[model samples]
Target chain A: MSSKAAQKQAAPDSPQRVLTGRQFMLGDHACAEGALAAGLDFFAGYPITPSTEVAEHLASRLPAVGGRFVQMEDELGSIAAIIGASAAGARSFTATSGPGFSLMMENIGLAAMMELPCVIVNVQRASPSTGLPTMVGQSDILQARWGSHGDYGIVAYCPSSPQECFELTIDAFNTADRYRIPVFILMDEVVGHMAERVEIPEAKDIPHVPRKGPRTAPGTGQFLPYAADADLVPPIAHAGDGYKVHMTGLTHDERGYPSLTAETHDKLVHRLVDKVRLNAADIVDFEEQDVDDADCVIVAYGCTARSATAAVTQARAEGLRCGLLRPKTIWPFPEARVRRLLEIGKVKRFIVPEINLGQMRREIERLTQLPTLRLNHAGGAMPTPNAILEIIRS
Target chain B: MSTPQPNDFSVVHPIDHLMRADRLPHILCAGCGIGTVIHAYVRAIDESGTDPDQHVCVSGIGCSGRAAGYVNVDSYHSTHGRALPFALGIAVHNPSLTVTVISGDGDLMAIGGNHFIHAARRNVNLNVICINNFNYGMTGGQVGPTTPIGAKGTTAPQGSIEHPFNLPYLAKACGASFVARWTILHVRQFTDAILRSMDKDGFCFTEVLSPCPTSFGRRNKLGEGLDEVEMYRERCHIENGAENLQDLDIDIVDHEQPITVGNFVDIERTAFHA
Candidate 1:
């Protein structure tokens, strides 16, 4: 059930109608289409709220593209199959919500440790555990960071729009490939399931990135698998490539064999950790909206980014100077931009309206050290614009 | 032509080093069961003659995780209770890599039991050597997945109410292709079982019942009464392996059945990736 086929836009019965303009697509559907366009060959996932359409769309679409789609036993098995497929040289991915995201953790850490590139889309929901499966919440912020134990780094991206969901998903696959790490798309349920005007870009405009394989053979001396070059990613020789590459979750040397000594442990851990953090600029992608004459800044991400833009527009009409700070790259959180806001004296009251009970709020409070109200709602709902405006007014 | 040959410094040839006895490149602790397992593994590898880097060893958290660290082969040390999935990942990725999961009983049967059984049921082509030390030797000998019932130890004060996992029997029931059990006491038997496991193409699991000698040894009378060597000899037996769990009779602290060690299950099936 695997194929090396590329996904093209659907052809219509009236073929010669002189097609112009753009095709409208749902955010979740765009993600599926984007995955196919980016050369995703295999998808294994279970149905979960809001994000179910991504699976449904892919299940029907993959076969048409001559690719593989499997509805696995459960989220755990789904992720396991995807991880298996990814390692087998198939550009693979899975989409899930709160509970499913938790199930993917075991293999997520495996991907991080083994340095296998795979994308996981988590449609954020309200949850301690299955709080509100159908509702929206950004409470999974910390879970995305330290959910899998050990001292390793993973990249998480949050797209504000449906178009971004499509484009950023392709970016997620590219980042996973380039860094040799697991990259997450932590889209809020609101944006994920929401229908919007996503202009599906033609293939020529889409920026596609592929993983680099080793140039030399196994017997060559300079063929250490974990040896990092300028991009902080080593040339990954696939398992079938005869390059003799070994990968694992254990602390290991540059050669990827498990290491016990303090020196190797320190070196190996440093490389895994530093490789992501050092190249943050190449990784960090975000947008700053309307900060020229703003006094208060609402730093937000995911679905809240959409709401914050609305809140800013409303606040501007009410004659309150406010700016919207949105993060596209959620991981290695944009500390520089927050610092930039403080440096510019544009942000006085840094208020963050998140779905969780103040996960990223703490980061803002820590960074700006200004009065940052969590302005949080529990699981199952998004923070209302009126509530956020109240915090700004106060 | 003063070129240093790959096989010149070592007693065993590099070709044997592929999946053979001489390519074990790890440091050994004093009388460690892992060392014995490595000896058996390399010898089996020598016999099998797969590529050195092609034989990938994956292990979960614990001292056993260090096995991959020592070997000069393709290996992975993964999170606790996760070697099965990691090994399965490699097995599915490259069917040619002689896959092995060198982990502890706690890492497998305790926390990793679900993954272990699932892998067995799926019958992925891999070798799983669950180093059963009766207690969590890596974590200072807390009770392990293989800790015998009525044996006094940490986490089980008077005695363990929980019965230990009969690994080979469990694997056989779960559709593994090869299942065997042995003790560190008998080096030759352990090696033989590992070799048989390597030769078998499906999910081959060998539960090597090793003694902690320090933790389980100190707490139980078996540590004092029966020396480590004699304990395995008294309890272990080579069986036809077709014997069901109900038929076997064993008299021990656990009192379930004798630790039957042999080529228990060897069947034909498609691999996970293949």
Candidate 2:
């Protein structure tokens, strides 16, 4: 019954599609390659600076592998298309920048509410409104966490280098599938544009996570599309799979019907949030360096983490007790690790350096309630190692 | 409440197999035409002889958007003004599924207008059923892009001075492979139109001119739902293959003006791909 187009399954990672070897590649290109490796079946995107390469590269690469890529009318359509594809049981995604990211927020919330699995790559540029479209910014850190209007939990990853961009994008798709929610690769313009070594492993070696499907057989007349098990995640039934699943953006019950009661809303929303919140230990990932005995911890992510790592090294050479803590998963913000660092009573202060004025620093301050200083940059440029060192010295 | 025994309900609805009968007592008000349109849609699905499991219905937010929920298919009720792109995603990803987008006028031609034209222009293979009740019925009959000029709405209490779109012409101009319009009163034709659209390969559109008696009808002095159907019977004329689609604009304010309804455009076009 499948149409000719539908019969063309996303080709297994071929040598032509997957550049399986160590090679210098742009962060955006590496992100696309990573999606290809992760068995991406569909991608919809709009052209925005720092993120356009991700789309442009995928446009050519996806077709080669029999996967589909669509340049949608706008960011709104791009995100909407990916959500639809995801609901249809395709491993789908979309890439955008700050302004486009803002346009995608409403649909992102829908994906969260519907518990659809899709990846979103926000190659963030400086912005409130089209600020430094071609330059770097980490200001969207908070936006990634709170841009979509709602209380649902989301997963976001901040990759500091091209290699991490490739690696974390796969993780983003896996996490999205695991939780049946939208996962974000919150990349900055520097990381998106910078060229660095990306080690692409063989397709078999790359870890991939397929979507969970209902154990209930088709035509059983017993499948409840939104009935979650102990993990609070319902197995998704793809459209046209004879499951007759009805999914909606409205608050729904276990049957996926619009149950607009306060009780159903409360239960549905709490499950949406708890799925990730309870699994925070497994979802949250970070790298801590030289923090066994340090008085100051420099917390950072994305491109700024590179500068923080340099600053930590310089502080150590200069006989100062400073360390670096970089969060790979930004949302589910490594609170436990930061709290543990604080409880040890060794880390007295935190200095967060980023391209943004102060986004992640606010999280650190809010969580630890300690003296936290920010090495601020209003984007278009990254803070130098010396600038971060000055904050650590202070 | 106790579950009724099988013997207690001897008579089953003819289209019950294709409907979420459990979700009945639908949200539609008395005299609304959305129910009729959904009926024709489900009837067409039954007559199509295709696997019911291979059908997917998607709807954006509005009165007509509820069609997705009521349809006993793998369906999705997406956000407002996004059903076209969402359906496009499904259609493009898995063309095996006969995806249909059922939405209201404001949901399709207003906020979702961009997606509508682009999807048509790309010739995406999906069926679109746009229920045009002249105003935003769910939002208390506010003025919308399809509300005829000089028509009264909640937002335009005096009259809607803005121009409304001629939906059939818009769809045709946007390169739809098949374009048709029918009032809900034309139940048989409407069902056949939907069935015909399901057979087309590229983008196909069927605009359903429905009545929102509670919200739009009362405000515009269009009387009850039956009165609106009577009006359609009086004014509507089937004109298939009519030339100069530009003249097919609907004028509710002037009862003397004719409402042209027919399968206006049907031609082969290459469906969009990656």
Candidate 3:
């Protein structure tokens, strides 16, 4: 297919594709809208707590805009279906919580190995296995990074409110398309369920990224599907397009044929990791306030960052030097900024507050090696602003 | 110029254009029937008259799953027990493409059973081919969901105590539009059945009883792969319009019982999309 035809099939400009202007919306519902704006051609999901609203909204909305949505038999099928759709050159995604996310790990690894671009939204809830399904938790930070076995690089965005949920979900899709990797939107139960104002821009204002098509023409017998360009990402060809591409989960050579040699595996694995790692400067995003001359910096993300922001305001009113550093991109962990804060030498200590038990704290501690304090709650509730204030005062 | 001799190297196999000859020397064991089944499948595709580019083959993890890798078309070798859902994704997203899943009995009937029944219940448009070798041939002949009662596998040295599934009946019960059964020895019938299924509108299933001489056949005293083919040739009977599918079950231990094989179900239904 021509690139123009592929783009038209992927992103149809229907009136129902976007709900313009500000409106009161749940975070999950806003996320569904973001996907539509990002030209989501397909969505396959199994309903799970704290994330079902995204699937429920898309069920009716997708059909209205000439897209497809399928509620699969289970989480395993959900992930697998999206991966297949992605390989067929559709912008696909799925939503789930902790338990369902656990079921999707194996196929997530398959998607990584195949280098299929898709999005996965995980609305956080308490869990060691079905721990509070209806409550809030930020415990899945590390799980999002290393849940799938093997070495690969991933991109994840933490949306703190309904508005960020709308914006970051679109960013997630663009990143997934640009890098040909699975990007995640990590939302907690608080942000998913909270009703707030979400300003959705018109469809023209939304930035859309299309999947890169094969450079070679069909029937030329020269199309190597796994051959990477200068960006270390391979172009994809869909089924029925006559490229006759072969994709497998095994270690493959540039021709997409299984090559079970250590040299082949080592080359493929390193490219998978370095594609995101070397481009971290462009992938990572964060927000900071009053950190230029502060005695302590509180690093947080997700809904906990909401409370941390308030704590910083309260500390300023009481003549204390406290600042808030909120990370928007979690996986490409915003390490450069944190390292800069440590080297600036104005900060005496770092405070990390989250709903989980010191998940993000360990990341900060490892990166900075400075005095990092954890203000943690197991789940079901956010850390109170005063609790975080107390850590800052210490 | 003199006529080319028979030993001249100018001639190639007829189906060479439809296969990835560079990836040859397939991983199937000696005397296995999967290669024959693949040949029949490729012949059916050729006969169907559909654009080769529009035909996609998906497979799960097993020896038979490698069928996707050999076919020179847009194909995928997905994770274990997930080919049905994966193919469902491709079919639903692009209805113009003809999607087929070729997998083993253990991969399909055991681990992927839920997906199979649900896909049939929804009447999704897909052609699913299950190669039943009566055991997990890739894993060295362990007892699988289709290992008949009183048969011996590596894991069932004392003889398998559990009953096997009647695949056609299960597929018919789950509302498939077309269902059939055949052995690899019946290549003409198998290829025709595959073409018939491909021409149908909803979920279609075909079970091919193949020989695993290295695994299931060696342990069960079934002699070589040719001997197993002879058994299928002598013991198999055609009963296309049988009323009671319940009697279609196979008992390999009972030498007196004849194996029933036919294209049993063919009807129309609304296929699932989106």
Interface RMSD of each: 4.8, 1.3, 3.5
Angstrom error of the Cα, residue A249, model 2: value is 0.9
TM-score of chain A of 2: 0.97
Q: Rank the candidates by lDDT, best first.
A: 2, 3, 1
lDDT of 2 by residue, A1-394 (tens): 3456645564576676678898899999999988988888899999999899999999999978888999999999999999999989889989999999999999999999999999999998887799999989888888888888878889999999999989999999999999999999999999999999999888788887777888979999888988898988889899888999999999998889999999999988899999999999999999999988999998889999998889899999999999988899999899999889878999888888878778888888788878888788898999999998888877
- Candidate 3 residue-wise lDDT, B56-106, digit = tens: 999999999999999988999999999999998888888778899999999
What tens digits encode model 2's per-residue C-alpha lDDT throughout B1-274? 5667866665568998899988886899999999888888889999999999989999999898898999999899999999999998999988878999999999999999999999999999999999999999888989999999999998999999998999999999999999999999888987888998899888999999999999999988899999999999999999987777899888989999999998899898988865
| Candidate 3, position A305, lDDT | 93
Best by TM-score: 2
Candidate 1: tens digits of C-alpha lDDT, residues B1-274: 4677885754554544343133254443334467666556666666666556566667778766666555556555666776776566556544556778898888888877887887887777788888877777766668766676677677888877776777777887888877776777766776777777776777888878666666666677655313754766766677745567443322247523455655565667754533
Which parts of model 2 have CA positions greater than 4 angstroms off? A1-7, B1-10
Query: Residue A293 error for model 2, in Å?
Result: 1.0
Q: How much is B2 displaced in model 2, in angstroms?
A: 24
Taking all chains together, each candidate's TM-score versus the true structure is 0.82, 0.98, 0.97
Residue A124, model 2: Cα distance from true site in angstroms: 0.9
Model 2, C-alpha of A229: deviation from truth (Å): 1.4
Distance from true location, Cα of B193 in model 1, Å: 5.9
> lDDT tens digits, residues A1-394, model 3?
2242234353377767989898899999999999988988889999899999999999988877777899899998999999988878888989999999999988888888899988999999987789999999888889888999999888999999999999999999999988889999999999999989999888899998777888889999999999999888899899889998899999999999999999999999999999899889989999998888998999989899999999999999998998988999998998999888878889888999988889888888788767889888999989989999998888
